[model samples]
Target chain A: MDIAYFPGCSLHAMAHEYDTSTRLVCQRLGINLYEVPDWNCCGATAAHSLDHHLSVGLSSRNLALVKDMNLKQMTTPCAGCFNRLKTASVELKQNDDLTAEIEKLAGISLTGAKEVEVAHTLQVIMEAVGMEGIKEQVIKPLNGMKLAAYSGCLITRPRAIAQFDDPEQPVALDHLLQALGAQPVHWSHKAECCGGGFAASDTDIVVDLGGQVLEAARQAGAEAIVAACPMCQTNLDTRQRAIEDERGIKYNLPIVYFTQLMGLAFSYSPRQMGLNRLLTSPTTLLRSRGLS
Target chain B: MSADFYKPMRLNEIDSSLQEEIKKVCDINVELCMECGKCTGGCSNAHIFDYTPRKIVQLVKLGAEKTLLSMDALWTCVSCQLCVDRCPSQINIPHIMDYIREKAHRQGVKTRRINVELFHDLMLNSIRKTGRVAEAPLMLNFNLRSRQYMKDAVLGGRMFLKGKLSPFSPVVKDIDHVRRLFKKIADNREG
Candidate 1:
């Protein structure tokens, strides 16, 4: 279960919780996460927008680095990084001409690491730690803790590229939540865009679209929302207050990363799961229910 | 990356007057258009707009100002950014759309239903405070403004009943950075 890990930029800074929780949960689940040697940014949102070839070239350099490491697989925690790497890999794998051009530009050669899977942390968890194992591991079992799973656009979109799950309706996270003995509420906007990078340049659309997803989750009776992407976490949990103020209604739902919840159900403390980093406290609810 | 993939079915070039205005706003070279139509295909509003991505680029290239601005199609974009994400040419069609829509708004050419513009105001207001988009409050404001609050009244009440939406503001870590960014964008618009 050992794999090369790329934490990307945000995981070390703003999303320290995701980084810490990922390490801790992998430890508990008997999986190994070795940081990719001297890894760099995946050229996530910015590189892709500014120049197509430059973005692919930059991503190819990272991939070529991994290929040089001789690693067969790499697991990424951030959804953006995952998408970037996978997109580049898909392009390189499918378009030989593109690979040759990018290699020329990047000054590196990719030996086409066959089936060298580039996967999100969630997919790795789902595959390595099956639902049955997860259910058995649940010491706290978020019992009756209603949750709406937000599977934003990246991991599931541009259908031809990612193919992680269903494009329109994804249920991988939902299935995982239900197996963990919690109620996973149904919502239609699960696959909607969270306006990731646009949040910086176009704030208005980000809130408006993100709000719709949150509202739908709320309507479906979720006590909190679970997401795999940190951007979604930032939008739903951190910016939730402004959404409230702008519209003059309250949405106090706790936003938790899937791994954090896994850590909790596996008998880990808030400290172990980095729950303190969250703006909305779900730990208190867990403690009140005598689970923490 | 094949530039020939999107052959414009109609309106290969825009009118000159509209071209100058669009170029002034976008300021980026629309001539680098590669004719990819990725923008049109991924646009969330394309379903509602007559100008597909190919058509929009064609219009911009031909400088079709009167037709582009006069149409209500520009206002329907949610700006979710799918087109921007997929565009191989790296053209920010949404930004172009925004500039066009803003121009239309200034000229008093608006929709009978102003959902996108209203959403924009609420969204910007939310981001100014939190540095990100918050859902519950934005929805409430959007619903209230659109006078469709009753549509999701039960859901809203249920959320309140379950403490999903709260009255207290959540802590934002970098309020100043957010304020500065918002102000800079706003100032740029006015100038």
Candidate 2:
């Protein structure tokens, strides 16, 4: 399947592994990712706080760009970007005045009301590729590697905008993990808030909230947590030391993007999937299981 | 022994106009909140927030504008929207929080959580100039502006060493168009 892609900011820098893995897995699965031309920031978490029309205008610019492409669909790996784009689409479609104002501000007519269908990569993989299709393409099963799927907020909240997922207890990530021959551990915080976009400003809240998610995943006996959102990845993977210091326990849990694990199951090397670039190394565990 | 007598003690500072503005701007039906406390119960940052999600709603409904605007809760709200998902009332707590924060920021209310606001503003400016954020410079700028020097020093070092921090800002093609968009937004110069 061919689709326009928006990598967001994280995929370019902090979460490049997610981007590379996404590319690798998509290649293996026969999916085409045509990046949206000259995409700007989706105005996540920031613009809405500053001005509502600004957020809608900024995010809808990408939608307008994609609409100009005559592309019926666009996919994003970052939950923040996905949420902003989806929100803008919903807002633009619902409010004719809003749509007119933003379109005029952006100097481009938005086709979001017509043909644009925004989706996250996990949705595309599970729904478009199908579990059986993914299972068939798995050259190397994950050997039952325990993975706790973490679906942070923005992807499923308010249910109306995201329009999919079991908002409280999402299972799409679990389904994708299972298809890759990984064990999807039963965990409650799969759809919990991860103190997103706060890691930079309020580090304490992220450490505390991220600690809860990691500890819960750990208590569920998950070897590692998998996330679709870069905010979740950075919060969980980047600050384990602080969480450990605060909680007085060692949680050496590595957070991997779902696409990276899928790439591993599909026989893509660590280098190819950019797994080696992870802050918290997945090497030792993969090597221990002779999967590396 | 009705609760109304006791309520006035805590809710004496009500401004009805604030409630009307919040409803108009944030689109939150604060009146729909049944005082279930489910939003507070599910709030991930409740411990940090001066007023938890349910209290914020109640306060807004009661028009506790000064309390809502002056306090750190408006700034500390992480905007995760768990309250929105779980709220039977369908109150978009995060959007309301954003609305309150925006209002407060515009009113020049100094907050204990100023760093969060600074970070958000910095992000907007960064995007305005660079088109996309360069992790290294963005973090450096955030640290410098927030005045909490080197908070992520060790992390930044490790990330730079690992090539995660791109020294050069990525300016997208047709960046002039992006600049024009920013100018339009900043000046309300378009449409």
Candidate 3:
């Protein structure tokens, strides 16, 4: 199966490991990911916060590029990019005024833009490779390693835009973990916000909210937290020490991308999955489980 | 309840222009709200917000545009969309928050959380310049502009060691197309 992929800005830089693992895992799953050529930034929180039209227009340009690619579907690894692109696709199809304005701004005729469907990479994996299919490819079972499936906010949010999984209680990640032979622990902060896009702007918000997420996962007896979004992984992993320092509690939980875990289950080496890139190293935890 | 809760509010005297504007722009009817605090209850940042989602809707109904635009909630809202999804009426509080925040930005209203706005501007500036955001340089510029050079310094070192921080910024081949969109938005806002 071939799908247009938009790695977004984070995947190229701060979340390079996510990009590497996503490509490797998708290759193993027999999914061909054709990157959308010359795709621009999705304008994320900044565009949406200041100018709604610009936000839609920025994403519309990318959607137009996907339309040009002649691909019916486009998928992104970043939840923030997925939200923006999906929102733009939904809005342009429904609101003719927006479609017209975006065409004028983007200087491209979005004739078949509505035909392009935007989905998160997780949705792609779940739909293209079913639970049974994933179970069949598990060369190395997770050895009952407990994990907290952290969906963050944008993956399955607002109910209308994402249009996949439950916004309140998302279980797709949990189900995927189960298929990988990992024990997905019941956690309260599964779909909670990780203070996204605020890690640079306001560090305190991430520390406060991310602290709660970490504490919830730790309380649920999760050996590690599996995240699908780069922002969530970055916030939870990088600021963990700060969160510990502020809350005066020890939480040495490593935040790993779900793709990384899938790669591990596919018998890929830790270095192949870029596991060493994680701030809170999962080496000790994985070694304990004998899965690494 | 506070004694102010019992104070009779003259419905005829209250200006509903803000609510009217929201409906006009986003088609979200704040009047459809039944005063259910479920939005605030599930809100991710309500504890940190000066005006919760429920209160922001009420402010719109009362035509408290000044307060709505200048409130710290405008800057602090995480846009998690929990409030909108949980609302029985499905009032898009995040959309309203975005609309009001944009208005505040256009008017140059003084935000208590200046760094938040500054970071946003820097990100936009990066996109406008290169058609894509370079995380490494963007973070550097944010730290420099916010005057906290030491912020995220340790994390930066770790990321650099992990080969995450790329020194070269990625630029789109068709940069003119992206800039035109930014210029058009600016022109529209001005006109």
Candidate 4:
């Protein structure tokens, strides 16, 4: 019924559309999202790269805050944040000293640390709002639009930490897209890295990796790419033109949030879901399909 | 995926302290790596990294701290963990890479692919000040600082036009606590 939500840094800014759509979609499902009070950065790729303690501290702090909210279930839409939070939870269970230290900082003992569990929004959607629950609520069937469901790196990698879906070949996002009447395209590089964390400083890597994913989707004849993480959406949407220019190919692929597509199926307005915020501009594809 | 580097490493010159630090931080049994390049072969960013996953662990086990810390290989690892999943030894290659990155960042080693280090610091600086990242300014500042202006300028312009680049990024009320949290952790005051 109620769950602690940690949108992380991206959802509030570059990924605000993701947050908007996720919130609206969750609301339609009668789910309440109590955002973790005073949630800080998850200390993503940067924090962990700089200091292990800081990364753990940053992520574990949010988990501790979720406990403060009297909730054991925590969810984040960002794959990066989800992985960091899940890592903290899984690591805390491994080392008693680290758990004790985190407890000391949180002012709670190990026994009292109410088994905080972290879930990506994809898993949350799949488990909390099953396919049947979702199918019943769809007003727009998506009219069988072809889309590539991209889960990105962190959602289903490092097997032990993120055990939600298969690391190599995840079909949860594909299944959800299918439930909404969208044809989930079968692409080999669907679960590949999007060079998400390196988008800014190392744009080249992001270009290469993101380009590869987009190229694969294009090869599979996908009209758009559906992603559960903001970073994947950012990379897929922001760098498409450049990849096209460099590779001498044409892929006018519109990268969209899974929730944004869900919002469309739920008959939410474009403005309500921040649909216009997508950098790649889904106008043509959505217009062609009579979606928006 | 250019495999053009040929640097021979001798096993006789291992530094115990560095090995201990890497082992302690990463919590990996590097000795179990059977020279199986599966980790390196499975790496997504090995094309961009100088020290591939298996080589990173091999270097850490060899205690080649100077060589490992000198390159920007650590930052290139997006932590996809494909290597870890494929490793028969189950070596936590990404964690080891994270350890190397933490060390590189601490030592302030600036070398090839150094822009990634700038990116990491700028992101941390943004987060430390705002409690969350302001992407527009973060990207702008990162590009300006790293001199990568031409890469995403047009894309950013389009994003701004689309209303994706928000000018106002909220700073958490507990800004002081965030500042302290970062400071204490960086100063090695916390576990």
| Per-model TM-score on C-alpha atoms | 0.66, 0.94, 0.98, 0.93
lDDT of 3 by residue, A73-162 (tens): 999999999999999999988999879888887788887887799999999999999899999999998989999999999999989999
Q: Give a tens-digit lDDT track for model 1, residues B1-191.
A: 12432556354443466666666644556777888777776665565566676677777776666666766566545444467557776676765775666566557665543665566556546645654445566667777887765744654564454444544333346356335534543454567
Alpha-carbon shift of residue A98 in model 4 (angstroms): 2.0
Q: How do these models rank on TM-score, best leading?
A: 3, 2, 4, 1
What is the overall TM-score of model 3 with all chains considered together? 0.98
Which residue pairs of candidate 4 clash?
A: none
Of 1 and 4, the candidate ahead on TM-score is 4
Weakest 10 consecutive residues of candidate 1 chain A by summed lDDT: A46-55
The runs of at least 3 residues in candidate 2 whose Cα sits more than 4 Å from the true structure, single-residue gaps closed, are A111-114, B1-15, B188-191
lDDT of 2 at B55: 79
Q: For all candidates listed, what's the TM-score of chain B alone? A: 0.65, 0.85, 0.94, 0.85
lDDT of 1 by residue, A67-156 (tens): 666777898888887887887888778777777766554445666543366888888888898798788778888787788888887777
Candidate closer to the true structure by lDDT (higher is better), 2 or 3: 3
Q: Mark the 10 consecutive residues where model 2 chain A has the least summed lDDT.
A: A106-115
Q: Compare the candidates by lDDT and give the number of the best one.
A: 3
- The fnat of each candidate, in order, is 0.01, 0.65, 0.84, 0.77
Determine the backbone clash count of candidate 4.
Answer: 0
Best by DockQ: 3
